[model samples]
Target chain A: MTTVGEVSRPSRVADPDEAISAEELQLAARNHGIPLEALRYDVTPAGLHYLLIHYDIPDVDPATHTLTVDGAVARPLALDLAALRERPRVTHRVTLECAGNGRALLHPRPVSQPWLVEAVGNAEWTGTPLAPLLREAGVAPEAVDVVFTGADHGVERGVEQDYQRALPVADALREEVLLAYEMNGAPLLPQHGAPLRLIVPGWYGMAHVKWLRGITVSTEEFTGYQNAVAYRLRRDADDPGEPVTRIEPRALVRPPGFPDFMSRTRMLRPGPCTVDGRAWSGHAPVMSVEVTTDGGANWAPAMLDAAGGDWSWRRWRFEWSPEPGRYVLGARATDASGRTQPVEQPWNRGGFANNLVQRVEVVVVAE
Target chain B: MTTVGEVSRPSRVADPDEAISAEELQLAARNHGIPLEALRYDVTPAGLHYLLIHYDIPDVDPATHTLTVDGAVARPLALDLAALRERPRVTHRVTLECAGNGRALLHPRPVSQPWLVEAVGNAEWTGTPLAPLLREAGVAPEAVDVVFTGADHGVERGVEQDYQRALPVADALREEVLLAYEMNGAPLLPQHGAPLRLIVPGWYGMAHVKWLRGITVSTEEFTGYQNAVAYRLRRDADDPGEPVTRIEPRALVRPPGFPDFMSRTRMLRPGPCTVDGRAWSGHAPVMSVEVTTDGGANWAPAMLDAAGGDWSWRRWRFEWSPEPGRYVLGARATDASGRTQPVEQPWNRGGFANNLVQRVEVVVVAE
Candidate 1:
């Protein structure tokens, strides 16, 4: 274990003018986001879903692997894969977005995973509700926070430990929260935390820990490295930032037509075209979605589909008759809570919770 | 369709000192490579498999999709997914690698997919042999090349067409060549060319067209864009270089210890450790593998496991005892065809067929 003061490489914002460093490129190559065109599918295919692995995927043998629940519980329990499957199963269609989805777009980019609005996916996860399991274990009255630990181990900012995070007792016992063992009707893929993982609905991906192995109920706040040093909305190095929770309002426009091999600029023959995308928010239901043809100078309301699920994204479409010229397309969403996607990015030291409007460049050509 | 003369964007090499451009970063985010740490598995899991899609994954409905085999064949046949699955089925453990696996590492890097040596995966493909299907269709005596076309359509360098590639008639009829519909005991995932795809063993990934929709046997040499223009080993724009075919010999060491969050420099305690990795070659079986503790200054032979399959990667392991220090670990493989991984990157205009030695940096700390 590394002390907080024995830092080797401290976090720092990257120079806006500099190109992506080799280290960022290395992370980008390992982790991937869904192609914008994949928005056509309601439930993202397993392989096309966005993925971010903090460390390595742990080698797990499912037959012998067991998850233990203890600490401040009247009855400690060790559950195997078969035991978890035998319980009442409930499936939910949920949308998960990384807290740092627009990190790279920040003027002074954060040096972690350099995501750009594509680090979000909607999936159908099947598992038993976590509330029932906690009830079966008979949680003690003094429990304030429940910490979930995963098998993936690594050194992040000089701290060597298994990945862990804690949720308040109220959030941990929500009916929608699950100990997910399956994804899209199939057993979890290795990269997706095979055997078991934690799924906290209406929260950023950081709250849903993968490769989950142990759960501990504590009386006090669990201030681990992840909860204390990472995933916080810090304004500067010295400021003790607030913990980042829940997904922010976001809308992404699928790039129209075909993409150029090198530049990825979209091209299409000028004519009647239907532009569509997906939008979601964790704080409240999305009320409206808007589209922009000439960047942000003008905006038009788009038709939103019926609510799919409380935690899932809603489809929005706009009809347009385009001309032969270059255009920058954009999309923004407003939730029932009055939270709206920002036209300009809200810069932070950790680049957390950035929901900047998406802008896609397209070229409409003469037929 | 775009004409050859109406060029929109021409190909060029990137400045050596320039950081990765936004365009390259966009492509990197869309397509992902397997993490080096995933080398521990003999057969890569579906989600962890390296993927490189040239264009959008076409919306494929398995029930309605039909594969047409036409052109110079004596009898034309349009087979649906059910008919193809009913034919004689065989499975092979084969390794597939992208031609531009080490593209980003080239001095003047190619501006396409900025891959950094992780664009390879070995999977078990279940499908019927293409030879029996061609024999049933009755191939024309004068047929010279077989062109396979995929539903993924996009523009590359000015030419717009479905992603297509051609193989010589002799190579197309090889017993190992398959019209695959399954990967790793499961039905193909959407991004992996659901319904059907071609599997050409011992060839670079470009030769194995995905989302396969049509097969046309022609009498003349097929000069398609993917074959004639892309995937070529050109030195300059004017040079009509040789076609890149087989996967070059290469070895990658599974990165040891834990990684730092931003820099990815690994750290571990000083002790004895066993370093292992996977190695393969499309032209021939890997005969020997060597490891170096001090960059490439010295090399020692590693123990190679018995061949797993004719076309699959073989495992190699090396045991080392080290004191506290910094080390640049390296691995290189030599194939039966006398092709060995080059210490220096062999530069090319397309950045194809680069099998440079793998280097990993690690720092040993006192316990």
Candidate 2:
């Protein structure tokens, strides 16, 4: 058993034959992904949204909790929930995907949250733009990074600390960045980070810190555990690895028909069926979505909905007519930058940013 | 691989040493349990409330949805959402627990949802009482059971059908029975059976059918799959087990102190601490809650809060000052009917109604 202090060692990939540890199961039970069927909704409901709380949700009293801006800022300001809400509010339909969305699918799984492909949600987040707040506080000219600290506290890989992450000054100053307090027009739910949380549109969920409490303008580069040690793509334990950022181009098909209780295998009648799904990319606008009914052997373009906001996912649909048989349905997306989802993602030590094409097995029975 | 028509065989208990199957992991990823920390709230928030969707969340259009009452009822009628909301309204805080909550904890686990102890939530359900509606429909005196059919349709063990369950006439007519359309003071989210659902206050969650659309008063007992085949306590494949019903007494402690990310083991400085949790029972009001620091060897009574409503859980707390060391904390509850939570629940084939005592591991370090 790995004790508290002993967990400081390098990340351990589970043995291929080993069963999921009780510890991983514990995390999976608490954090959940949006059910693939939920893709039917234009905006994911608050409760059905994918949630990844690194630690315990800090108890924040809305009346007393305040956001403190300090460090290299010219004017260190403390804003309460009411003050933040009084600012000009904007709502954006943004898609957020966890960096470890496909961690459990890796061959030697990185032993963390054990997520499959379901860890993604698109929601309308309402809040004041973060750039204006930073401008009001007057960021120092030499400030290289902005560090966001959340009230959630715990030990990650043996380091005892509050959850913290740093964003490059340019990214922090982006107009789309927000101090969101509402999700889907409702005050943020506790599990979704009530009081306040950061929303970095177009970035993976890790960049959007939850239960945010502090913003520190740092002259020096901020090297926090979350940004420095975790959420990195590495080949092995010894590699320093590149920092993971942005959502990779990926597409998922809402399982077309009803599912079997235990196996979740899709069972549908043989006929013409219109399959639809949502696709998104953080690097650039999703340029195209492709569907394949016979795995990846053949592909056809799917009609895309008129582009949604720059950060939200776009819906796409493909028409298919098939005879009664077993078929593996696959969907893949390509961004304007020409980045496309891979058929097989390379294995990484931390299991970060594995965006392989999704495949759903469907059995069309003869009616 | 189990295909569409091939799953009609007897239920299979997974090998004790086998890893969780892809199917079980798929289910776990889609459904979620309330984080134990959520126990802090009096009423579980809508999103944080545990959810278990047996199949797909039926895409319901509230504007067009209607509830039909027929069968042994003299006046067959269809009530639209507006008509149902025109009736007298009542709100109740009810605690619902899944029958398979501790299934994965069993030695030869049932190959289904694979839930731990977290599949329980207390929430406020608002709607009109059911007895009046039945009376308005003029149910015949010969009606022995009322059958509920939900919009959610799927195959369970090769049986393809809309989700359906039956309740005895007396239980269905209980004053507290409701046809709930709202949860936590808001319209039901799509995943939670938008538009309408049934709330059998004191019964297991299986009885509170989601996406409810029809009610049929039956002359004879309805031997539907859900009532006679599923959700039963069986000794083996051939054993005709007793039907699982109301919840058993159980207590859950909110994990204290901070947690290690991967292991979720508690790390707190040695000092005086208040260990608090919630306890409830459907058979009777919870009479006593006991706390233990050294596993289950020694036990002490905890203070209970003033009783909430009849179907809701009551809060309890225990104070302790312990020295620095590792200790396993345990909590158990006993109801007014003298039914206490078992230390180790007897294993059943379907893994229903297994309410074992909850044990949390904690490491109290010197400050």
Top-DockQ structure, candidate number: 2
Off by over 4 Å in 1: A1-8, B1-8
Best by TM-score: 2
lDDT of 1 by residue, B60-152 (tens): 899999999999998999999999999999999988888989898889888889999899888999999999999888989999999999999
Question: Quick one: how many clashes does candidate 2 have?
Answer: 0
Which residue pairs show collisions in model 1?
A: none
**TM-score of each predicted structure versus truth:** 0.97, 0.98
- For A270-358, candidate 1 gives per-residue lDDT tens digits of 78999999999999999999999898889999999998899999999999889887788999999999999888779889999999898
Candidates, DockQ: 0.54, 0.62
